[model samples]
Target: MIRLLRLLFWILIGRPLVLIVLGLNVRNLKNLPLQGPAIVVANHNSHLDTFVLMTLFPLSRLHRLRPVAAADYFLKNRVLAWFTLNIVNMIPLDRTKVGKRGEDPLENCGKALAAGEILLVYPEGTRGATDSLAKFKGGVARLKEQFPEMPVVPVYMQGLSRALPKGEIALVPVVVDVFIGEPVAWAGNRQAFTQALQDSVTALAAAAPHPTWK
Candidate 1:
């Protein structure tokens, strides 16, 4: 029942909002993973980033596409918690209790990957300035360390910040460009792997066509 509801929501609402109302110029769709135990990493800007990335895959595979989200923000309210957990199918990572005794922040993520689920991660940890790339956290690298063979795909999105800026509620119509780069491999060390992933995303961003907003 939950799966049906999720499919309906994305097919009826989420996809239309992202692919039509907002508009998406997706490049290199072939780079996306058709199966999982995979990680799709992108720069964080706005909340719409998750929805946009989810739309890249076929609705049938929506069940396997899990976005790694913060527990505090998404699960703060009961209504939102239920919706995100069930409808959006998010894997919540507790950012506040990272280093506490016996707390595994990436535990849920690990389980998801072990189950061959595709994880949509924002390596920036949190959203930053509009169209600006921030320093990536080491969480993704840690995940890669655990699953050395898993493919880490780098993606860059443009114009999402302008479409729905940080503090604004109403979404302005903006054409978003999505650039998917080749899969990044583990570089033997977490720091080097994280840096390589960041570099791949930066290069994709640099290749995106600049859009003029009136």
Candidate 2:
């Protein structure tokens, strides 16, 4: 039922609806691992980023893709929470206070990756102030540290924030580009690996700022 609903949303609404606004350009499509359990890490600036990423992938993989989202934001509303859990395949992480289980939030992420699912994460922890990236948090590093064999793909999203900023509700039409960079190998040190991961994203952004609109 969840897969059917997601297929319907993507076919009837999600993909077609976004074409009216989003102009997605993915560079180095081959960079996306042909298989998973892999992790795609991107800079977070807007909620729209997740949709943009999913729309770019084939429907078959949609069911296999899981996004790590804020438990506080997506889970508060029962209706939205239901859709997020069932349709969106979100792994809700508690960014505020730890849950009663006291388990590491990233442990859930690792579990997903271990389960052969494609996981998407925002290492910045939250939306940034602008197009510029915020210093990456170490959670992503910890995940990679645990699953060193799983490839970490770096993706950079530019212009989505303008389409849907941190505080806005209404969607605005804007040309957005999704940059996919070659998988970056994790260095042993967490700090160094995070920095390298960040630089990979930066390179993708600099290489292709946006698609040429004609």
Model 1 lDDT on a 0 to 1 scale:
0.90
**Residue pairs in steric clash, candidate 1?**
none
Model 1 clash tally, residue pairs? 0
Per-residue lDDT of candidate 1, residues 92-141 (tens digit): 98987788898889999999999999999999888888646888989999
Cα error, candidate 1, residue 180 (Å): 0.1
Error of 1 at 183 (Å): 0.6
On TM-score, the leading prediction is: 1
* TM-score for each model: 0.96, 0.90
For candidate 2, the TM-score is 0.90
Predicted structure 2: clash tally: 0
Give the count of colliding residue pairs in each prediction. Answer: 0, 0
Instruction: Give candidates' CA RMSD values in order.
Output: 2.3, 3.4
lDDT value, candidate 2, whole model: 0.81
Rate residue 122 of model 2 by lDDT: 87
Residues forming the 10-long window of minimal summed lDDT in candidate 2: 205-214
